[model samples]
Target chain A: MRFRRWILPGILVIALAITGVWGYNQYKIKKNYETTMQNSYQRMFYDLKDHVENVQVSLSKVLLADSQEQNVILLSQIMQQAYLAEEKLAQLPISHKDTAKTEKFLNQVSDYSYALASNVLEGSPMDQDQKDALLKLQNYTDYLSQELMGVHNKLTEGVFNIGEIKRKEKEDIENANDNMLNVRLVKLEDKMTKSPELIYDGPFSDQVLSGKAKGLGDKKVDIEEAKKIAQEFTGAENTESIEVIEEGEQMDKTAWIPSYTFSIPKESSPEDSPIYIGVSKTGGKVVWMENSRAVNKPKISVEQAIEKGQKYLVEKGYESMESNYSLQYDGLVLINFAYKQNDVTIYTDLIKVKVALDTGDIVGMDAAQYLKAHHDRNIRQPELTQSEARGKVKTDFDVDSARLAIIPKEGAKEYLCYEFKGTYQGGDFIVYVDAITGKEVKILKIIKDENGTLTF
Target chain B: MKKAVLILSMAMLVTLSATGYYLYINNQNQNNFSSTTEGINSVEVSNAEKNKDGVEESETVNATLAPKVLYWGSTGQDVKDVQWKLAQWDYYNGAVDGIYGTETYRAVRAFQSKNGLGVDGVVGPETAAALGLNFGPVDGGTQGAGTTAISRNDDIYLLARAVHAEARGEPYIGKVAVAAVILNRVENPSFPNTIASVIYQPLAFTAVADGQINLSPDADSLKAARDAINGWDPTYGCRYYWNPATSTSKWIWSRQVVIKYGKHWFGN
Candidate 1:
């Protein structure tokens, strides 16, 4: 009876020790995971704080800047900072619904700053309204930075836990919003939305962009119609070879306007990079297309490439198009064709055609600019004669040649000028001359690297 | 006049880039980087001449007589020289800073009126000539001119085409290896002395025999070609490559394998 009593108690003691070790290891693993998660949250918070601080500093610089050049730099900096802050904000593991307003506020700041910078660079002084808007933005950002700093300090002191808030957000967003950080951010966004309406011509102005492609007309295109537009653009019709799959949202955010994206295979194999073509649901206009497949051999000359590109443009209802410039890379030549309205070159309306040099196939095309800006333009007749414009060009340099071309000015301004392609000191340059004023406007030097040409 | 205009216009249209009737004008415009003070504040000639932003050209404000020219606020080392030269000539009695400030502007106007040139207060081709500076479009940030240079365009294209055909489906490194193999052969006296001779030698690359080599190449192939030319030999100077799946010759297997990159087994 004494031996049996000892056995039962001894077994109980061993079982308790085993449970103790297992529990300790489990606790250690969980603690490590929590620390890692907390570190990332702290990193993002610090990054947000730094960017917001930069935004404030750059904004103050903008107000104090006396020169337009300095002002442009400051504005560009503010834009970059705002964009970076918004990017970091997206990385947070907070509830999406709660952070939506905060994210929108950051997006506006980025968009607004970019538009202002673009305007300032164009020699247009910021008007009273723009100044007022910027002052408000600066003050608002100052407030945001101060509040973020408070949250960060509190987080580091263990007074508030960002990790806890994020974990709770996954379970219950309302419970997460009860946290001070979310409440404060939401309040800041609300205040920003209530600020004076920003109405201007800069690209970020939602009112101006309309998000609707102007050149596409008013035809409502369904999925089937969109497929036909894709077929016409890629010439991938009547073939079992090309697999067409519709994509809801695009991975690349280059295009300003949203469209119905379609992924179509260029070859029969499953592994090849498929051509991604975006067609606007309205009017069935082909906005953009990219073929990521590797081009083969250069069996055709550059002239053949241009000829093939031109033919494809004409077949797709692109009329009055003249090839602007061609850049050769790999086995393909990307030719930028701008729409010609009258004798004037409408540079704002541009379409890029990628022609394969091996077989002269149109592998890629991007018509976003063309679709957004194309319209019948009322071009004015120039006051100065072509000879008068020519006279203004440097007489010493080998003038090589000159032609009438309308190039974009700051923002949406367009100038009908004489474009002179000349060689000076053995380097090539293109100089633009305002036709009416007979004044030399801008000069761009073409840099020929061993790889290819880059102009500035 | 009409005949002269017609000829000039025709020449302009036909005068493409370095190559004729093929490439278009390069479109990489101004960087909009305004870190430093741009020289010359004078109603700077602008490409945005007229459209919607009614910020009229400052030069064109009052004087159709001044003509479009470079004036105040222009920033460059040349501008400093212009200032120093003008100050030395007693035409401009201002600080010899490169900036075309108000003082420089006044001096330029005074000098132009005194010299019987139009008193537009701007530097035109005539004023530039009077100043004795070679007034061609000289930019400070221009890429420095290179000497001893000539590129074989046909060679780059051929190499790119060959790489694209043989390994279009392969990884980027494998693609470079394909181009590097051709380059390695060109260096080896045992093979060929030039890229063209090695790639076109009879019974060599399989793509040449089939018409696959004639297919168009993509951007990656071109990048690979450029890299190969720039001396990036990822194959460590290997001489030959053959797919292990199809190599039937017993003699080819005798060479020591360098690397089995992607589908091809490379050897020297």
Candidate 2:
């Protein structure tokens, strides 16, 4: 009896001790992880500060430099430092809201410097206006660098815990605005917003940043008209009801095509699966449509699916569309159809159609690219014949076929080229040669597997 | 004699308790260490569980050292793996019958020669790497539910995992919208240029930070990713999205909210 009593108390004591040890260990582990994460964030912030300082210094040096070669070197340094700074800022834990304009400033600085350097390299002297822009950019970067230094000082002094701020923000977002780092960053953004509007021959130039849709015509369509278009696009017989869900009013007026979004419930579709269609408000044309109904096992072949998609596109008034690439996944085959004009394929005006392999029905369509870039192109006669362009390709390419095509390039440019498709070392490749200059323009390797074919 | 017996039993119980405690502490320490890193340890845990089914521990070590070479007479799952990979590439016309016969040997030789490897019929390290089969002990096997014929590095597969992790509970349109946001960021000059770069940027995506991006995507998420890649901008080029109720950052509220789909508020 004495031993039994002692055994019960002994077991109770051991259980209590175990619980205490486990809880303490867990706490210690959590603390260690938080410290490691905090150290990482600190390191990222310091690197960002250093890069911004380097950009500021380089911008000043570029302004003082006279020789074209010296200016190019300094500008390139500025571009590299600005891009690195932007990348570091993005990796920080700060909210994007506090860093939007700051990030944009860095990107514009990089792009503008790159464009200026290219101009210099091409033997074009820097004009007075470009010099003034560089001076203004330097001033902005100077201010940014100083502000970042202030934040760095506060961080080093442990004015506030960065990790604690992140945790508190997640727990209470409204109260997170009081964080010193966020306040300083917000102030920096305000200053950046006042920076000069930069326009240049670059991808991030103001004009290219606010690109307009060339194909969305200027004819106003009301909600009723848009609903009708959506219903017709989704097949009026299969639609039970269509409701206006949202409008694209929040998009920047110059950058995006405004549209009326609608959700239509199909009569025979599964629960929670509805057909969504976006009709451009300018014209009654359907911008995009998707039916998310689950498709059964594939019964139709990929070729049959492609044929069905082409028929659907024709029925919907997409004429002269030539099917190009097709990829299959999860009981669906997505086919890309590009516009063809006078025996030349226009890759810019593209449409994608997703056909259900189970029933060969058109399940999805995206005409956004078509609606953005489609227009009547002025066909130009090729300076080089098909055989001449084929000669530009490597002799070992083993070319199987060649055709005329127009492909897109950077900075909103398009190149008319003769596309050559063939095999090389058991791999399929598409080579594009400029029809005018016969210069090799671009190369794409086609990767094929049981899933589908894709270009890399 | 009775007292002696009781004392002996008591000593045994104490020893048992001490050993149990020591083991519990060791397991906890390992778990703690692994949790510091993300995504990889979950696979290790599953692998450890799989080893309980009478698999010799030494075999696992061997598998880890190097994948087995399949010769003419090799049979079992490894042979089946070679057959499947060869057939997918149209090198092998024989059945995937888990037997390395004359047809399999010829296919291996052809593949080796075509890929600039030594013209040997044996399926060795170089051949397996070319075929994209690691056969690591942790991977368990080549055939599994999540192991599709599609390359893991494929853009669609990566995007599908992101979509599934970020918006598994969202409606189909919402899933597409999430993918569209990622794509829009890729196009924007302020962000990284590549899809993988943008998705894996530090603290850029909650799914990647939380290790959920390693999960296998369902069919709907895969379809959503494909639709987004095909140029369907359901969010109309919005580059940011967040759940309003759960969003931690106060700065996201300052963004111009473009659309609300399911629980996410997409913004520019």
Candidate 3:
């Protein structure tokens, strides 16, 4: 009887010890994870502060420098630093709403600096208005740097905890607002909204961002018209019941092409996943369409799918679209078709068609790029012959074929070039030489494997 | 005396037969050893030649002769040929000096690894054939079959995982909208430029924080990712998306909701 009593007590004590150890280990693991997360956030915050300071310093140097070379170098530095700062800021644990204006300021600064650097390289100095803009931008960056440094100081002094802020942000928004870092960042963003409206030849320019869809015609289409267009685009035989899911007014009026979205069930099985199609409001053109039905094993080849896609495009009245690079994945083939105008391929006007390899059916199509960029272009005879343009390519590059093409550059600029496809040192490359100036405009490396071909 | 002589002759006959049997077995073993080595050499030669035939369209008489296997410490014209090929392919930086030294060995190993051959730093029949060197017979195994073809791009795979984790319970269009939002973030200057950076940005995605982004995606999620990449923007360039019922941030509510798909609301 005495031994039994001792045995029960011993077992209870051992069980309690095991439970205590397990609880401590769980606590340690959680603590370690929190520490690691905190460390990464702290590192990103410090790097962001550094990049902002560099950008400010570089902007100041550009304003004081008189020599074109020095100014160009300083402006390039500002551009790079600003982009890096933007990248770092995006990586931080902050909401996009709190950093929208700040991010826009950084983007504009980078783009403007790039434009100014290119101008200086092309033998033009910074004009007075440009100098004033740079000075204004420098003042903003200075303020931003000061605010960032203040936050940094607080973080270093333990007045603000990034980990605590993350926890509170997820649990209590009011508590997160009390964090000094969040308060300073919000103030900094408010100040950033007052930055100057920059008008220049760059992508982030207000003029470019506000541009409308060029390919949409002027005639407005009603809901009924749009539904009919969707049915026709998706093939009337396959579409059973079409319903207007969204209207043009529902989307962002400025950023997106105004369109009417329709969901149509398949004729074969109306209960299955339906096909979604978007028809533009102005021209009643099909903006995009997708049928997400699961595809089975592939029975057709890539070439056959390309042919089917081309035929589908022609049936939809998209003529003269030449097949370009294709990617194959998940029993489907997505082919890009560029509009061929007057024997010169217009790369900006791109259309992608996804064909299911199982049934040779055109399952999806996106014409957003084409609708954004397609327009009539004046055909011009090349000043230099193809052979002369070919001379601009590297001598060692083994040229296989050459053709005329129009390629897009930065900020709405397009160039007419002689496109050459060839191999250099056993790797495929595409060289674009300006047909008029005979300058090598661009070089693209083509990466090919069993999956598909891609260009970089 | 006659019986003793008979027993001695019988013993002599047994000894002669045993000696003959031993000689026959020894000669057979020697032949077998030689033939086995020859068999291995022929197999290697044939494998190399098959690869050469796949790479080069025209057959040359030089391929008919067995070529010497080059490795570290090898010298002469064969090493020079390998060095020249590697240099042309930008895999080698050393001088093409007729001698296979440490540099040549490293280059050979790198080439072998990239071409999916045995990475021994030795230019055996397979490596030689991959280099388009004229060596060995012309008909054997399929060439380039050892190189694995990637089925999907890494970005696509990552995007699919994110979609699966975040929108697996939503409709097909909603899943596509989630992927579109990720792609739109990549394009927006306010966010990072790469798909990975945008997806992995600190606390930007709930799936990543909850350890769900590591989950394998279903086929639907992969199709959705590809659809988004193909420019099927169901959300129409909206950069922010959230399930209002689950989202805790008051800031997300401040943004104007542009479109609603399934359980999520998309906004700028």
lDDT of each: 0.62, 0.74, 0.75
Question: What class would a CAPRI assessor give candidate 3's docking?
Answer: incorrect
Rank the models by DockQ, top first.
2, 3, 1
**lDDT tens readout by residue for model 3, B5-111:** 55565555555445544544444433432332232223211211111000111111121333358878988766876887788677899998889999999999899
Candidate 1: residue A288 lDDT (0-100): 63
Cα shift from native, residue A341, model 3 (Å) = 1.6
lDDT of the structure predicted as candidate 3: 0.75
Q: Which tens-of-lDDT digit does each residue in A80-194 have in candidate 3?
A: 8998788778766676677778888898899899999988986789999999999999999999999998988888788867767767766866676677877898999888878
Per-candidate TM equals 0.48, 0.74, 0.76
Off by over 4 Å in 3: A1-6, A201-203, A237-240, A247-255, A296-299, A453-456, B1-152
- State the weakest 10-residue window (summed lDDT) of model 2 chain A: A447-456
Docking quality tier of model 1 = incorrect
Best-to-worst ranking by TM-score: 3, 2, 1
Q: Cα deviation in Å at residue A156, candidate 2?
A: 3.3
Q: Please give me the total number of clashing residue pairs in predicted model 3.
A: 0
lDDT of 2 by residue, B164-262 (tens): 999999989999999999988866776754466567664577777666786666657877886787677898788989898987766677777777788
Per-residue lDDT of model 1, residues B1-268, tens digit only: 6456555544543442122212111110111101000111111221121221111121121101112246878755456656755775678777766688888888888878888877887776567546533243222244435211122333566678789888988866578769978876654323323454455442366575344665555557866675565444445456677777876555467655655456886666
The top-ranked prediction according to TM-score is 3
DockQ winner: 2
lDDT of 1 by residue, A1-456 (tens): 868645644554555455555555555555665666566667767898899899999998888888888888888888778866765565455543345445555656666777777667756788888888889888888888987887877777887777677456446545767887777776766765665455655433545433445687877878777777777777775434444442212211322444565667655665775666667766788776666555554689877888898899998899788886666655577777878876777777887787788777777777766776776677878888877887887776667776777876533557889888777777667778888777776676554433233221
